[model samples]
Target: MSRSCPSRDAGLFPSEAEIARRLSQTPQEWAAKAKVLERDGLPRVDPLMGGRFWPAVRAYFLARYGLAGAEALAPDGPENLDAL
Candidate 1:
């Protein structure tokens, strides 16, 4: 008898590299922006993962660009950016 393996779901978040690519910025620039966000009391990056999840990224976009800017960059609605 063959045992079935569970399917793995794709990660629902973008990595720092992906974020940087989307923003047309370097990884270092993204990291610097992340630092500013943290200093301003936004969600901190995951220390262990060295990355931000979709919510954190969304917050960053909103904070940096405002609603209109985020809407322009997000292909789907800004609220749906993190939807899996």
Candidate 2:
């Protein structure tokens, strides 16, 4: 799950539970985006993250929560930006 940042603020990143919650909030939104992605016909799957489920799931998370309006959650080049 979540790992506390070593910084003074020691904020928490999304845990598996948090990620699940964020992902669960708006399945319709994710389905819509996934449709667009499917139309575009990109790889839509990243082998690095254990097959096809992760990309769509991660996309849903990013669209729903990993972004703040327009900026990414960790915009200084997120470690897993592409996944989301």
The per-prediction tally of clashing pairs is 0, 0
Which digits, one per residue and each the tens of the lDDT, describe model 2 over residues 2-68?
3422341122332333333455744456446556765654234444532235445555545656462
**Which pairs of residues clash in candidate 2, taking residues 3 or more apart in a chain or in different chains?**
none
lDDT of 1 by residue, 1-84 (tens): 222222211243456656666669887797787677778755665776544566666666677666634443446535665676
What is candidate 2's local distance difference test score?
Answer: 0.44
Candidate 1's TM-score: 0.47
TM-score, candidate 2, is: 0.25
TM-score of each: 0.47, 0.25
